[model samples]
Target: MSTARWVLHLPAAATSAEGVDRLAQALRDSLRHVPALDFGELTISAEDDQSTRRRVWCDAPLGGDRRCALRTNHPDRCLDR
Candidate 1:
């Protein structure tokens, strides 16, 4: 089987990177039921500079094909959901 990637550009009223990250997390949480959505791979970028992206999740490999469920750059130890 083949998998395809999809990108959705959402415009938000957040004024800072942290605010945007929160918005992204809320969106992922609301859509958690969708199996096709890879919450761990979530990212955000400025409207003008899509080339530079900021990750929303830690997404570190946690063995057995599991990934960290913490936010990006989290100070605590990685956890899997």
Candidate 2:
């Protein structure tokens, strides 16, 4: 791994189907547990990409797109982790 920062290997389609507004809410909800210092630019995909799922990274998102719902929307994954 290139020592750049985090490595959040999300499923890519963490929160799909849900509207963008709901997704953004979800992302915010997830970030509550994380510290702001670990924050980094947020990124998302219209759908799950095989390549991205393999290389997970976690950079705190200040905020994200209001267009697509988060790709990786797992309820258990959020609160549990």
Number of clashes recorded per candidate: 0, 16
Instruction: Give the best candidate by lDDT.
Output: 1
Candidate 1 residue lDDT tens string, 1-81:
888878765567577887887888888879989887788877788768879987889999999978998988999999986
Q: Which tens-of-lDDT digit does each residue in 1-81 have in candidate 2?
A: 676766665433445534543554566667747764222244444564534522112332334422222234433322212
Model 2 segments more than 4 A misplaced: 1-4, 12-21, 36-40, 48-81
Clashing pairs in 1: none
| Model 1's TM-score against the true structure | 0.76
**Per-residue lDDT of 71 in model 2:** 31
Q: RMSDs, each prediction?
A: 2.4, 11.4
Model 1 clash tally, residue pairs: 0
The positional error of residue 59 in candidate 2, measured at the CA in angstroms, is 12
Residue 37 CA displacement from its true place in model 1, Å? 0.1
